[model samples]
Target: MAPATQPLLRAALLLLLLLLATSHQATGAVVATELRCQCLKTVSRIDFQDIQSLKVTPPGPHCTKTEVIATLKNGQEVCLDPEAPLVRRIIQKILNNAKSS
Candidate 1:
């Protein structure tokens, strides 16, 4: 190994270790409930006891603008801010989506 590149190699290795350490905190394993997006939907039968806050619209057989704050299956409370369209869209899409089991 060239002595001139030793420092660069050490820095690269350190960066890799740092990334791995932080990623290790959150296991890649996703709970089955988490996979089921319907849990976020108001019409879904899935339980929402874990949700901290919710603002659901009147049930009329269709989804409404009023958002609902709920905890994900992973025991994470997700706040669906009305102002953030990105957040609202992503959550709604996921909650209403179905994946082959």
Candidate 2:
């Protein structure tokens, strides 16, 4: 109703809309995976004794193949093929360990 305050109200509304748009863009953003598949290549077998730890990431949107990453005693990481017999046994061992604990 007041002409003098109309400009101020318009500016405040504009600022609110701008802030909302920026915040939404910052929070509701899709983070694209840098590496679609973490393992570009995999080894059929690796010495079981040398492995310090193992991590398995199941197939998902980022990668179509299951990934098995092994950390060696020397702090080195290697990818092992899931289809490999040795790798399967190692995975089974790890799963058994988790179940027992």
Residue-by-residue lDDT tens digits, candidate 1, 38-60? 12422222334444444333323
The top-ranked prediction according to TM-score is 2
Task: Name the candidate that leads on lDDT.
Answer: 2
Q: By TM-score, how accurate is candidate 1?
A: 0.28
The lDDT, on a scale of 0 to 1, for candidate 1 is: 0.44
lDDT scores of the candidates, listed in order = 0.44, 0.73
Off by over 4 Å in 1: 24-101
- lDDT tens digits, residues 10-70, model 2? 9999989755543311112222224576665678878889989988889999889898778
| lDDT of predicted model 2 | 0.73
TM-score of each: 0.28, 0.63
Local lDDT at 96 for model 1: 71
